[model samples]
Target: MNYDHWGRFLAQKVNEHTGLDILKWKNEKKHTWEALSWPDFYDKVNKTALALLDLGVKSGDNVAIWAENMPQWLVADMAVFSIRAVTVPLYANSPEVQAEYILHETESRIVFVGENEQYTKINAIREKLPSLKQVIVFAEPESPEEPDMSFETFVSAGSFANKAEELEKRRRDASMEDLATIIYTSGTTGVPKGVMLTHANFAETLRTHEILLDMNPGDTSIAFLPMSHIFERGWIYMCLNRGMTIYFNHDPREIQTTLAEVRPTFMCTVPRFWEKVYGAVNENINNGPAIKKKIFNWALKVGDSYYMNHKRVKKEPGVMLKLQHAVANAIVYSKVKKKAGLENAKFFPCAGAAIAPEVATFFHRMGIHLMIGYGLSETTATVTVNRYYDFNLASIGKAMPDLEVKVGENNEIMVKGKTVMKGYYKKPIETAEVFDGEWFKTGDAGYFGEDGNLVMTERIKELYKTATGKYVAPNYIEAKLAMDKYIEQIAVFGDRKKYIIALIAPSVQAIKEYAQKMNIAYDNLEELLSHSGIISFFEDRLQKIQREFARFEQIKKFKLLPYPFTVETGELTSTLKLRRKIIFEKYKELIEGMYVD
Candidate 1:
């Protein structure tokens, strides 16, 4: 894959796919889809690059973007790339201290924010960040003042093309080695370290994905995941490289509606998103009439035979089977898919954590392509992803083209690839510790299967040892139990303890429906969870889910919390991975009580 300047590359794509809608967003007031053509996107990006130049943003300088997914956010990112500057993205909901730490660490000259909420957070800590000079707000603020101007104003200042030559020169002199982004890892412990990625890293990744994935120029994708995370950021870069129309989902709460409206051909999401979908579908199926259940089950069986048995193996189904599939799709599968807003889904990549095999199978059976993959922030998003037809629900599939993957000492999954990060920004000692020669130590324990597919066993650091000398992989247990409809989040703990125990945040709405059906009495959430019926119900569900686990690995006891773990509560990272140590510390008392014999 040859590297080219982002400006030139985007211009080429625009010329090739002229009049195509490259960017889209829903106008809340107008209640319609607003679009930007490829030419419009190219024009906006160029103007934004000039605007950054007008603000004295020089090459190699770091610019912070503290905003949610929006058309302007991508515009800013491309502009930063065109100017040969580094983009340091902070999660839109980043707490004040963490946001301040990144700005101060990067010595960012300017930060672009989304709405007033993000602007307010930056405002409160701007005084503490001496290097931060200007704030460009994407949305109009209640009171726009000095040093804090609207994004429109920032773009208009460049409309005169005052710094056009400077922007052009910067793009002309752009190098593949130039820092593309400094992504801060949302660590489970210790301070976040910035993973430095270069244009070469992104270029190689795009090339590999283009070779492996079958996406086309006219395909449509929805951007819902926070772009600060490498998974979404890298995927979006590839989406644009393919000239796909991207719908920016500004409000995550409206994703379901947006999905229905857009009927996107492609999107990327974490396992948690699918877990909710699985739980909800099961809930609806279970609550329906007897005939409905019968039809749904038969359709799924036919779908499994057609998709998994015949289609996946490249075997043509018989005439009877083909007829059954068509009937199933018409009466059952189509309605279910249309209701879930995935009727038009072509390929949906799921990553960040392990997805339940059942969940993956369910989506596949319904003809919603859920491609499960594995990687970390240091790996530039995907090291391996399940292929279109030949995929195993039990494995994360083979490594990307031209990438090396091997299991080293201690069963650590090591990767050597052009897509890997340059290094952790300014953390030489930390970076040195993670690498052994040319291979990057992924810190994940996995081994290549007989079929040459990688099956991740556990995060080496997350293994828990009990007092009885039994070691447990928390992620394994958690992923298995997360399939239950009642569990929203869980943290397994047993290190140096007598037995495995857990802190569970049950699905409140599901439980409420359960309560109503079971005729349970309760006035509030606290009372409902404490009811003996609810307790017994959870115990039964947990036991059923962990039936295959060994005695030592099974969770012996658990404490249910009234609320779910969240980013705001410091229990989960921005990517929705559990901060186990933080969760353990916060629930120490409850965890200790569960271990009492």
Candidate 2:
């Protein structure tokens, strides 16, 4: 229960308590699940930490970890924290320049490279990293060439007995005030600022959830999201504290299949995945024969009606409602949930951005307990999360217990609590600007509903003023546009222009289907995207959604991109958030062409 005692806490679970499984993973050979009885887990962590200490990695020194969601990454993370060294996680998908920026900013002494690609990235920028001393590559001897020492060699160099002694010494010196990790924010600004999270900061946040959610050691978690984000970091630590088993996903592409195999009790995800599930279901229904499509449509209507009226009034559903609801659940919803690998899902929390209220309602209607939370990295992860018992479709639930949240004079959500970070790392002026007295300004505009639930409107910084002096929130418009299955990514422009325009990326799968229906042949994706008929189809849909927005906020002109924004392209953040400035700069010419006379 004492989250501050992370070192002793994990050690106790590993040594004394042996019933609970700790971590699980699958490889080419077989699936492996390690219980608390496994001394190998503890041994690797201790030896790794001791090896770092032997290599001159000291308390307060930053240890950079560049890896995907693998067991070694978790081991390195725990070891770094155990040694009282600050852990800095670099997104595995990060560009070489971004990786260099993080390394230089963190002043990391030793780096842990996941594999060949990570090693290659570091090698490209190693010369520019003044503080970096050594790179410990995690791969087999047969693996591709890498920098410095191999992980096995580094651990082998340290005596296990000596490592145990060093771990004890580090634990004795560790305190609540010591910096735990520096999670860099994935922002549009070229320079990523590290959010310094102290041991007490994460400890209190995890403990708050532990009490609120009743998390236990018997619980299991499937971690797919990159651990570089504070959301996953906090969740992983919470799992560790509770002695829950964590299954590291092997193939991200096979997430659904992996979930079916693991059957994890709980997980967290962004709303985009949920949207994809919805789109897939819709596609299946559309592809079916006339009778099946009609049946599917009827079932959806029944489900929607039941969801809308369930708690309010017990209407004896007419024969139609009864028959339609049964058929829908049996044929559509059941198969959809099964395919989503949520057959045994206990709790699912959706965050990072606002989900469509209809999407939230749809899942809830299907007996899915999906809770929505709202927060940013500066808040250390979660400020407000919808409680399981007191759920609402339109609201982002109430604030977490012990956290203070209020709307500022300008409608910005300001929060002050143990969960808040220790200001931005090394940016005193910028930090002071956002911090008002005691509360940390969220920079998001929102208000509390009558039910005391937080209702987020838009980002204060993202709001744009039109030529007519009207303020418009692009996110609201963008969310509406994204609800159309054909639309993948849209950035609503027109900050000071006459009206809003947009940069849109259509879903390739959806576009290809449209092409097939129209009998328009295409050789490849590029030709498909360039087809005028396909572009016009999207334009019509854009106009239809434009009616829902205010006149000033309507997207007037738009440009369709050939490809969707991705992490590799440096257009989207690791969390799948758009880098507005980067996108605008990258497509400057295209954007100008849209407004040309």
Candidate of highest lDDT: 1
The RMSD (Cα, Å) of candidate 2 is 3.1
**lDDT, each prediction:** 0.88, 0.80
Candidate 2 to truth, TM = 0.92
Q: After superposition, how far is residue 463 of candidate 1 from its true place, in Å?
A: 0.5
Model 1 per-residue lDDT tens digits across residues 294-348: 9888989998999999888788999999999999999988887898778878889
Quote the RMSD, in angstroms, for model 1.
Answer: 1.5
Tens-digit per-residue lDDT, 1-597, candidate 2: 556545555686676436656777776555554433336777788888888777778888999999888888878887888888988999888889889988998899898888788888888899899998888887652344444777888788748565567779889888988888888888766578888888889878877786446467677788878888788777887777667788887556778877887777777788877877777777677878989888766666677676556522345567766676777889877776787778677678789888888888777666566778987788878899887655666878788889999999779999999989897878888889889888899888899998888999889988889889999988788877787788899987888878788988988777887899999998988788778898788778888867867788888788888888888888998777888888889998988787787
Worst 10 residues of 2 by lDDT: 29-38
As a TM-score, model 1 comes out at 0.97
